[model samples]
Target: MSLLPNTMRAVAATGSVPLDDERALADVDLPLPELRPRDVLVEVAAVSVNPVDVKTRMRRPADAPRIVLGYDAAGTVVGVGSEVTLFAPGDEVYHAGVITRQGTNAEFHAVDERLVGRKPANLSMAEAAAMPLTTITAWESLFDRFRLDASSGGTLLAVAAAGGVGSILTQLAATLTGVSVIGTASRPETRDWVRGMGAAHVVDHHGDLAAAVREIAPDGIDRVFTPSTAGRLPLYADVLRPFGEIVAIDEDPDMDARVLKSKSIAWLWESMFTRGVFETPDMIRQHELLDEASAMFEDGRLRSTLAREIAGIDAAGLREAHALVASGRSIGKVVLVR
Candidate 1:
């Protein structure tokens, strides 16, 4: 018998607002989500705020349903859909769910089994919650979108080194491949953090990105990865070697393909939700990647990028997290726990 209640409390967007304020997110009662085939009902133990959460809440229409805006979560499976085989009741898991579905801000969330992975045994729920969204973004950008081989032995310039995705990407590039990582961080603390994350060199993004990267790579970067690529695509084009790859995972509506024409740079975009949103045949790749990440964490090869932990899983805590993320100054990730 399931212990789930008919209703659960969720930190939800009451209305769209350009600024993060106390009223931005509120505690509301929502009916427990009904499961679809291959879905698992998770008893959410922890959730981490991402830039996507802040952006989605800020742009949501006021007339839309009260939106729950979390993407990354870790919890125990309380129930599973009929076709679910990867997990069962009582299995601990973590995932970054598709944006098309209800989010993980609620006390309970239903996620596709193919998008979920077993939680790393060595990390707590809060730590595991911090990894899903950022890790998936970084991993897919390097290995999938960029198609970087393990022994590529090239240089990579990662922009915004202290942010959620950049931190993990820097570490992954440094440890998992022969890539010489140059991470961009403007502030002193972020620069130090980037160095600690295994960047061979830390450059200030507020300065000339191309000049700074050239100082390190000299010839030019072999690859570039960034989460905030809007308006900065040309910087990558200027610094990247001819035929080098640039992978961006954020919304780049104004990005022009002409910028990379001269360099013959291959520009690619990686959205972590693409497979789940399209229900692609390779949707289970996310599961495989997270599972590999879990093993890496357990083996002490990778560390969770959880920087701060908020005490409660409520509206006030979520609002605080949103403000931190919106400020664009958070070191790693801000998590809320029950």
Candidate 2:
């Protein structure tokens, strides 16, 4: 702690502007964040950009203070709070920080130890950084929302299976449970990528989703996982069996729940930030799940979805990364490294 610096370099959203605008993100100097009772300070080595970063930047008010925006990070512990127990100085870790705090796009960051995990031995910082947020989201969707397990036998339809969360979700379902996975991807490359991740089938989302899914699973799907629910609930209802479930991560203002009433289909939302944001008693589950995922990664049962890496945690690089992610076509995850 005595060797720690007072200030650190960071990248932040200076104003709510388009990704191409120079004012969208900028380099800044920030004081080292204060550690809370259960907090640990980390020296960040790599961070991955998600869709949340782009959304936050675009939706932020012009008068709001410059806010740093990043979530997924892989780094080394450098300092610990009085109540911290899970990590010590020099321990390498990875985490997807809560949305309530300033983020991980900095030289140093402070995060709750309950949200951190030991970095997988086989992964580089960039690769590990690409995992935390997507991994948590996907894991919760399958295990917590859908309640699938090793004994569970069914068919799962994963929309956008080549995206960050979908890539890991497909792998987890295929490897950890008895379910068969049908992934949706429009492009040839992404379809191949989804299949490589362990999907039993890959269908074109640009075509008739219900018909395509029916051709593969004639009996109807047992579960559906999607990032977006805009204007697609009816199609999901049509393809899901009676008493099936749908887990989604995005917000859709026009979504109607009545479509599933007749079939008794359950529609659930999965937000990895819920436990941390509310300081729920079960917040520590994130730590446990991440450690479990680490073991899976180390044993070769899971793999990193890092598709692109940019050098340095600077505003220019982050802007490029953010724009790529905002394009809605980038496969897997994009990371920035020091």
Candidate 3:
């Protein structure tokens, strides 16, 4: 009954290399669904490249020579494993995958029912493709990492707000929490984008971030949500209020973060894949978060971060997108549309 190929085309990492200076993709054959009882076979139409994809592919686990390379995806379900209750054949869905599994940089993918969510009705596959990775990261940082309460008033700053997760996180802070949002974007256009997404203010990350934030908030920032680990510690130290929290989702070994202790500030690192990787008792929390996010999108409280759409689901396109993201110049999420 499946009208799908047995072997899917995936962009694989032939060898390891640094994302900035090397070729990570070498096209290859990846085994398609042979289906599990609770899986959904999705025909991927659009996918987004994240830093994780760039890093994992660049570090090609020499042992496993055929790892597919994407996480965020938007597609239509083509086949349903017997016990799939939330979706059926012909449903449109989007999700960021489990870190331990094969990814969405393929023609087709098989995923668990618990990890997928309905694509936003107002968005295209490319638009919806941008939400999952950002959503998961922001949600984890705000609610879990910082332990901020939605009913309490707080002030937060997002360093590098024009990036993928920061864009969405800005809006999430506005609508979900009782927090005043100050987003940092150096460029004029990016600053506008951050403010349009409901940020109370936009500070230039190019200037002294601490100084810019102080000119605007004068007192101090209660929390700093950083989607990048680049240049965070030094810039934030001066503006963080006592007991302020800092959360970063990027993988950077350069961060010691211990200096924050002098101010009684807390530093937190977030990774959404933690639930799926370890099958945490709250493994199903993603399902709940996606449901809530969907409602936010439906109610007009949340917006898609999709910025650029690249055609084709091939190695060349992915390489280009990865290069841009690795370059640290992109203003928002980029999607590879099939």
Candidate 4:
């Protein structure tokens, strides 16, 4: 087999957004890695678009030369750093790239062994690409935030349950715990999408979430996770039982926590990248969790969340994917094969 070549092309934002800013994530030159110890050089095969890309592109520093703009990907490792212990050359892997680093929107990406995991055996690279970001975000939010026991019984309420994160969150929680999942979605198609992901019950977010949730059980839910951008707290607070915990990945400056007084709620903001950012002792936990999740996928307990698989890796496909996520109605995920 031919060894992978150095140097690659990638999509990068050279200016600010509103993408109309003339240089928002166009094609750019990227350097290849020099084979750092304990690192793996993966030949990128596919990537997924998440809300973070859109947000980063919208707020990227204008003066930077050009910022690579993707996080989730699946690829074959062409080279492994000398000290690497887990993956070997030729192993296929999927992971969410570190935030401060150049992304996998290129032909190759050098990843820390701690952030990547073996891709599921049944999934193609495109299918595998759709999972990492949503799965990483959802897994950390519920498992890390609540410390949920794998065998515990509880009711999980997922707000905005048709989006990428919600889709995986519902399935993972449902499969890992005895918890019955109740997911909220407003549209008929979204309702079906959430149901297909293993949600035991569905409520419309358009109605009073508390009322809609109460209709299912007079007793409120045990845990809530929302990936919503705005007006999320009150909705979660309304349906959460006494001392029920809630977590969100988004920060709305206007959001007030005072409303959480009732239920003696535990509300937290979850960022999957926090461990990596702080170099916390548990940064390797992401690697372990993704491995476990992949095993579940292999076991047929969890399904891939990819909804749309676009062909070819390029700026136009990425832009279209980003727009779909920004529209807030996308169910599952979108993957672009390189």
Backbone clashes in model 4? 2
**Deviating ranges (above 4 Å) for candidate 3:** 18-23, 61-64
Q: What TM-score would each prediction reach against the true structure?
A: 0.96, 0.99, 0.92, 0.94
Model 4: per-residue lDDT, tens digit, 1-338? 14555568888765455654446657766778666676788889999998888888767567766778788999998888889898888899998978877788988888788888899998899989999878989888877887876777878888888888999999988877788889999999999999999999999888777888898878878888877737778767776788988788887889888888967999878988787667688878889989999999999999898899888778777777877888888888989997
Per-residue alpha-carbon lDDT of candidate 3 for residues 106-194, written as tens digits (9 for 90 to 100): 99888887788888787889988988878988888888897766795778888788888888888888887889998888878898999
Candidates 1 and 4 compared: the better one by lDDT is 1
lDDT of each: 0.89, 0.94, 0.82, 0.83
Model 1: per-residue Cα lDDT over 1-338, one tens digit each? 26679999998785676444555788899999999999999999999999988778767776667788889999999999999999989999999999999999999999999999999999999999999989989988888887776777888888898999998998888878888888899999999999989999999889887787887878888888887788988788888889988887777788787989998998788889899999999999999999999999999889999999998889888888888998999999999999
Top candidate by TM-score: 2
By TM-score, highest first, what's the ranking?
2, 1, 4, 3
Better lDDT candidate (2, 3): 2
Off by over 4 Å in 2: none
Residue 220, candidate 4: Cα error in Å is 1.9
Better of 2 and 3 by TM-score: 2
